[model samples]
Target chain A: MINEEINEIQNIEIRLFLEALFQRYDYDFRNYSQAHIKRRILHRMNLNNFKNISEMQHRILYDPSFVQQILLDLSINVTEMYRDPSFYAAVRKEVIPILKTYPFIKTWHAGCSTGEEVYSMAILMREEGLLNRSQIYATDFNHKVLKIAKEGIYPIDQIKDYTTNYQKSGGKESFSSYYDANYNSVIIDSSLKKNIVFADHNLVTDSVFAEVNLIICRNVLIYFNRELQDKVIKLFLDSLAPGGILCLGSKENLQYSTHFEMFSVIDAHEKIYRKEYRH
Target chain B: MIEQKSFPIYKPLAIVIGTSAGGVEALTKIFIGLRAGFSIPILVVQHISPSSDSYLPKHLNRLTTVSVNEAIDKTSIEEFNAYLAPPNYHMLVEEDRTISLTVDEKVSYARPSIDVLFETASRAYGRNLLGVIMTGANADGASGSKLLREMGGFLVVQDPKSAHISTMPEAALQLAGADYVTNLEGIIEFLNQLK
Candidate 1:
């Protein structure tokens, strides 16, 4: 058979695997970018010592344990505290003033990954004296990451990178003050942990949980296909209170989003936007 | 190497190019010689610093007849356009022919990995894909080119003596075994003749 015919057959098998995954487990990855999803599946297949995607799918249908591994593979766990320092700096300079005007603020960090950015935002709010009045909801589809994020314990080696990022983002206090260093890991200060809620929320399947004042779902939407991106952006628009600030990943934009007109750009470079008030 | 049998007769659907160390200059020369009316989509992974700007695409677009762009997430591949993978993301081609960017772990100490692009493009376009490995310091593209060849895709490597950095092409020649090993000028001549 020509390569095109083989490719077409392989595509069908992958869709079947994804469909079976959705029907068997409620984890809906159907709308995720097909290319990325395939890469992850292929990677997972290699890791599990399986030869092809069909073999992986066969096991996925029968083996519950294998499904868990696939879940972790599919959800990208790559993140760091204060990732892209300029993004945090923009949050401090551009968004903080508007946030300061509010009496009480509710911020949602959707797809919070392992909660590095959640802690980053909390620290920023604390420095601005907004933490006392703010409630941060950090959510991710992977509870494994959510648990790690809730504990706020990161490896000791990563602290240097996090420290440099913190200082670059205009951190007020010493970076060391925020975490208690154990032998191998540094536990984030319990004081900073206050007023933060870490929960399981799937951006693909879950609906709006709260009408937040500031929504920071950075770098998460890039994994979704354009159709899913549009749907999630609409969810963000629905979840935001009028004039609420929405911050996406540095590479993500609202240009193609149908709800593009609903938000005015606050910092075009940082991908910060504010919801337009209803007429 | 310029023999009739060496050239692919099946109207190539996509062109995948990989380069690293001296890619900008080498790719510039290759693209400058590319005339208008070539319709196959070009996907490129030029190793760059994660923090670098979109200057490469903008600069290449100025010198080339085909429009060049930094690949955007979920953008469909267009004929007569060259898409440069953005910094810090692995660019992959989907079965649907759309470009997908991932911030997954870096392969070969690079995120915009040529291996990732070539391997995924091979899966999408198969023998209809044209894979090129050019000047670079690392061996990132060797395995990818092998995958392309295994999938019955055409393979070419820049002649190592003519390359700015010989390690990449030399490694590809040793490991991937391309159908054609030619200089920049020869590569330009070959590409221009592709239907």
Candidate 2:
């Protein structure tokens, strides 16, 4: 069909644009899942009033500001406080006991958009009397989102959902005790932010920088192609200490990863896995 | 004659449906009557709570002869199956005839937004796409339905008067001006006519 042909042409243009972006900016999105990237590009096209991918490709090559805008659109920043409460419940019941054994705990919340989950983790640790011994590294590739994450503030309207998730996740204290409300926004308690370090780190381009006891990278790998996902999994494996725990989004699994055997499934429903030590 | 003129006769490569509020009941009526050997892929975005388990596909699968499943990210789409967008994610169609899922911020206060699916599928299928907006409480599908029509895709809406929650269909009719406005049974008859 003529429509199919047109789509194919658009696909080629999109690939070329991605390549040009990498060659010029060193932001390697070449291995991201194509369908997701394409959708983002199409969404960008509609917003910028471009007729086709070819036109967008031209602008990407010629305009720096346009490329930056596209980069923001391409990044998936959807997240919430205590997302998947059951996962947190599993963490409280299963993973935290192992974490308590460590003299000093190191946790990496990779792709920590706006740091909600990071704060959630800190609150959980605080309640368990482990906050003093834990250092949480919250990293994301998008500096724009990273800046917001460092602020420890969120819209007041979303607090209701966060509160429900907290109770579901077995919170010992009232959710209101954690934040100070300022009309439209809630500033997360300053103590909750004390142990968290927010930084810009791209899973695609960056190498493992720290050996951690637990790594929580949820819903981020779904955006990556299989090859890139394998690479990132390898990176996580290298970064994790022996017997370290890895928690993924409910929908994500290590089924296709080459390193699947290296990790023992801790809680299947929660998608929590523990790195196995070689005899 | 006027109705015939409005409903353009053309074979569509795929059908994209968006609904909310009373989507489960409305979708059941449409799927229950679908005859076997239907070939077009049906991608749907039915607004649901983020924490809710995906029971829609399973429920619909029992009622229809055609296969129905929750769409996975980055999978190639196949005809003869209805792919429902999973909770807390937006489902999109890509140029390679594959499904893409995103956790982007909620549009129109919803993830798995009807507008997101319709907008992307319209681009991928172009004039070969058939966009159907059904019973719901919000205006979420209106802009996306408009986009699909702009891309030359056929647009259809459930008659607002007959919809369980009329606002969604009414919005689609007001904003996109569908080629056909019919009740549930009338929409089923129209679908059966597609080759």
Candidate 3:
């Protein structure tokens, strides 16, 4: 019973600490679920060797570097190249048919951490004969990650696996033909990235910038609470052109969202949706 | 009768562990004896195929007292818990207070790549972290463990000879120059002392 109370108290302290973080740092975590927020902060605290949250809070309030460290701990930066290959395959099979009808295309990949998906799209476009005419916008909230994304270099040892993913995603050519391995790292083909622009954008706090023909914001919205998710969905709706394509992560959906009626499913298994034309 | 002196216990805030082929059984043995209410948060990346679905967390949760779950995007790191990177994704902690999921491409033929997690965690946590590299058939986690040690994090490697697959630990020792090299039972005792 005493242990349970200690756990409860720790939970309360974590909440207050997060509240204090918002108040002090202007990073809005107020909308995040308490369980997730508590876990992240405690993880950060332990990493910093703080015996308790109070010590962590004290350091974070005073030290900007500590705040930055805390921020790094809290951000969800896990991702991979050709992630969920079937989704890309679906985009190639289902959406490209409609995309080919257009003369030119502009696509936005929101929350494009380190730009693997962006490059994947560019490769797909190239294969579909749409590369020269299409412009891809890959955006993320973290500037540091964006820089790495722009570099388009990955560990060379991983090529064999990514080659398999590439094949599974229906690559037309040899995966090795795409990049040059320089010892330990693989530098992606510069041609594939030519039409791509990597930038820093936040879905939580930012607004839509352009009317795009397709919007691919996969695996990003799941982190947000319901309200924040709605805000992002609305943002995507506003940004997408009529009859545009919208692709989401596997677990995410447009159902129950305010913009649900505005779009229809292109491929349910792949979670691909297309904005419907009113006229 | 000789009474044992209770030594001062050191608790790590963040624990980073790495494994490859034959790692599941090794991890099960190491984690099985962990005391209930152990308060450190652990981050682990086991080498799994991009298509492999890990039932590791579920299995570990059943055997251990700590809460275990697949690491989710934006999920906070918590005390007395364990997080395993889901298959086909490299798990990284961002500089901000949220989890970022990237589909950037695989490192060393792994999606939930051990090197990516260990390197990023070392960068994020520095000396306050504890790193353990375990049994496997590959050399994936070696360089990352080296970086963790260079950054002042505590290093622990599983005994290579005792491991079912020794290549991973042998590689890590050669590359990272581990601070503590022991068998599974020793690691459990070490963790219990912390608890």
Candidate 4:
């Protein structure tokens, strides 16, 4: 058979796998980026010796333990503290002042993978004395990562990179003050942890849990197709208070989004936008 | 000044080009063959500095009729345009003909990896894809070219003797024998003739 026919068949199989995953488990990855999902599925198939996607799908439907592996694989967890330091610096300069205007702040970190970004934002807010008045809701569909995020412990070696990023992002206090090193890992201080709440919320399947003032869902949206991206953006719009700020990953944009005109650009290069106060 | 026999007869729906080192100059030369009438979408993976701004697409736009763009995640690929994988991310093509960018670790010691682009393009486009390797300082495209040919796609290598740096084309040639071996002008002529 021709490769295109083979490719078409493989495509159908992948869709069935995703469909099976959604039907069997509650997680819905059907709307995720086709390229991203295919790459991750193929990687898992190669790793686990599944001859085809159907084999993987059968395992997914039958094996709860196997589904867990696929769930973790599908999640885009390659995040770090203060990723793209300039983004955080831009946030400090552009968004923080707007954040300062609010008397009582609530921020949502959607897809807060492993909670690095949640903690990173907490540190930024704490440095600015906003933590006392702030309540941060950090959510992800994967509870395994949420548990880790709630615990707030990361390997000690990553501290150097996080410190450098913090210093670059206009951090005022010593980066060391945020965490305590215990042998192999560093635990985030209670001061930084007090106002944050980590919970399981699927951007794909769940509705807004709270009306937030600043919604920071970075890099995560890039994993979804344009339709899903727009749907999630609309969700952010509905979830945010008027004039709330939305920050997306560097590679993502609103140009193709149907709801494009709702948010005016604050810093175009930083991918930061503020929702218009007008209804 | 070229024989009809020199060019491959197969028409490709898409073209995937990999280059580094002298990539900007090399791609500019290849793009000169692009007329407003040329329709196949050109997907490129150029080894740009990690910290560098994604200026190559804009820089190359001035010289070609094709709209050259830095690839944005989840964007659909269009014909008569060139998309360069943005800096610091690996670009892949989906079955639905959209582009996806990833930060999942670098392969072949490069992000915006040539191997990643070629491999994914091979899957998406199959035999209807044309894989081109030009002057570069690294061997990033070798295995990808091999897979491209194995999947029934055509491979074109810039003649190493004429290349600014031969490491890339030579690597591709050594691993995946070229369907056509030509210099800059020959490549341009070949591109100009594409339907």
Candidate 5:
């Protein structure tokens, strides 16, 4: 068959595969960016050594574990503490001051992934003296990763980079003081976890569950198609209290979002936007 | 932006460029040397530290007449512009010909893998995609260039001897020999002549 024919066939199979995922399980990834979903599908197919998406679909019918693996794979867990140092720095300089004015803070960290970012934010809040007055909902669709998040254990080797990021993000104290190295991994200070509630939240299907002063969704929006992105942004708009902050991934923006006018820029370079106080 | 159809006769709709170690200089040269108002959307993947700031576009935009900016997710492939992949993200071409990015595991030890972009661009643009491999220190783009060639897309390799670092161009030649192997000036001339 011709090359275009192959791509066409693979897409059809992928569509069926996504349908299978949504129907069999309640996970709806049908609206994800086709390119992102295609890459994930191809990656999984190569790993399983399946000749085609059809074979993958066939296995989906028989193996429950296979389904679980695929779902986990679909949820992007690629993140690190202080992934973008400047973003955290902006949070410290811009958002923290506003957060201080409020008596209490509520934060919804959508797609918390392995919890690196959630813990990173928790550390920031602790330093800013807002941890005790803050309630953070760190959530993801993947329960498996949520368990890892709750533990706050990361590789010791990775800690070095996180420390550098921490320092660059205007860290006030010794980074080593935040965690205890235990063998190959470092366990985060338990104090960071006290204000964070790790839970299950699927951005794809879930609605706004709370009113919050800050919403840090970050890179999670890029995985979605434009339509879904707008839908999710609406959910965020509804969830945020007026003048609340909504930070997104570096590449993601409200340029094409339907709800673009509803937010004002706090830090354009850092992708921090505040919901219009009156709106 | 001049239309690709205005090219009397042409084989490419998009140009994809990838490089590493010596990429900043090489890409700057290509962008500056190309005729003003070059209409093809040049998609570039240059290796840098994961936390590297958005310096490449700012640097290039000041030097080149072609508007250069970081590729945004779901952005369309418009004419007379260039898009560079963001640091620590894998930029792919969707079937709709828009850009899609991911933080998937690195390919060939590079987040914005040349192979990833080339392979996807070849699929999206088919024989109309022109894959360019220039000065670099890694073999990230070789396999992707090979796949691009397999999909009937064209390949352009910067002559290894002329490259500041020869490892990348030489690797591309060994794995996916280009339709045109030339120096920086020659590549620029070829692009300008596309009009």
Candidate 6:
């Protein structure tokens, strides 16, 4: 059918466009699943009202602004405060106890879109009386989301919902105590982010930059193919200190990865694993 | 010049879905109406605790005509059956066209993540896909559904009001801006009409 041919042509166009993007921009989506990459590119194309992928590629190649917009579309950066409240509850109950033994802590929240999870961890630390002794590194490939993460501002209306999640996550204090509500946004207390470093880092291209007592790279790796997943997990294994905790998104695990034996599940339901102390 | 085909036959081979918090009730309503002789494949990723042994397939299978089972790695994705992504792994369609499981980290705070399965299937099947975003708490499936829509695949979302948890559908509507928005009953009727 005519429609089927057009669909196939569109697929080819997206493939060519991504190839061009890597060749010129060096973003290296070459290893990502072809299906995911194509879908992302096509979404951008439609949003921009380009007739086809070729038009979107032409604009991306020539216009930096367009490329940035495409980057936002490509990153899949949707997140919310205490998005999975129970998961955080599990962290507070299971992981915090072990974290208390460490003299000082280094934590990493990889693919921390807009820093919600990072801030959530900061809140958890504050409650556990660990805030003063911890340093958190929050990283994402999308610079735009990273910028938002740094700002630490969120829609004021969402506070009600986030408060509910906060309570469900077993917050011991008033949720409103954490932020000052502005006209349309809530400015998170500056102190919560004091030890948090929001940075631009790509799991696809970047290497581990810190040795940490705990690494919480929740919900970021699913975008990649198996080979890429293996690569990222390896980075986490290398970065985690001996006996450090590695928390993953519930669906994520080290079981099938090359680093499977490097860590053992502490709370399998929570998807919390501990790096083996290889002495 | 080619003759235009009338009422382009939409023989839906598979149905893939992503949902968050309130997905269970919504899925039950939709599946209950799809009787045993239904010959389409259904794959679903509902956000659940990694430790929670989702007896979802078993529960839903009891209500629907179609066979339901939790997806296993390397299993062939077959028609007239439903596959639910297991609790802690991302489910993907391999190049060999079989179900491939990944221990990859969660995307969008979910394992058996909706985004992972939807995005991968969009790549594997292109327009030969039907992606649906149902009721849940977070925005997990929005971008993936958007991707499927762009790839010329059919897109559907549960009407936010009808969803037990509206966040997922609301977010999908805002981001992907779906092609069809309907209640669970309506979605069932739509699925029936797909053939």
TM-score of each: 0.94, 0.86, 0.61, 0.92, 0.95, 0.72
In TM-score terms, which candidate is top? 5
Clashing pairs in 6: A35-B123, A219-B106, A251-B88, A251-B111, B21-B137, B35-B65, B36-B65
Looking at candidate 5 chain B, the ten consecutive residues that score lowest on lDDT are: B1-10
Question: Between 1 and 2, whose TM-score is larger?
Answer: 1
lDDT of 5 by residue, B1-195 (tens): 111222226747899999999899998888888887778888999998887888999999988778899999889988878999999999999888999888888999999899889988887888888888999988999998988877777788898999999999989988877788889998888888985
Report lDDT (Cα) of residue A12, candidate 3. 71
Per DockQ, the best of the predicted structures is: 5
Query: What count of clashes does model 6 give?
Result: 7
> Where is the poorest 10-residue window by lDDT in model 2 chain B?
B1-10
Rank ordering of all candidates by TM-score, starting from the highest: 5, 1, 4, 2, 6, 3
B1-195: candidate 4 lDDT, tens digit per residue: 111234556679899999999988999877776766678899999998866887789888878889899998877889878899988888999877889888777778898889889988888888889988999988999988987877778888899999999999989888888888899888887778877
- Report how far off residue B98 is in candidate 5 (Å): 1.5
Question: Candidate 5 — which residues are off by over 4 angstroms?
Answer: B1-11
Runs in model 6 deviating more than 4 A are B1-41, B44-55, B61-81, B85-195
User: How accurately is candidate 2 docked according to DockQ?
Assistant: 0.34
Q: Between the candidate structures 2 and 3, which one is better when assessed by DockQ?
A: 2
- Whichever of 2 and 5 has more lDDT, that candidate is 5
- Looking at model 4, residue A198 earns an lDDT score of 84
The 10 consecutive residues of candidate 1 chain B with the worst lDDT sum are B1-10
Docking class of 4: medium
C-alpha local distance difference test of each model: 0.89, 0.88, 0.77, 0.87, 0.88, 0.79
CAPRI level of candidate 1 = medium
Clash pairs of candidate 2?
none
Worst 10 residues of 3 chain B by lDDT: B1-10
lDDT of 5 by residue, A38-142 (tens): 777888899989999999998987777787799777878889999889999999999999999999999999999899999889989999999999999998988
Q: Rank order by lDDT, top first?
A: 1, 5, 2, 4, 6, 3
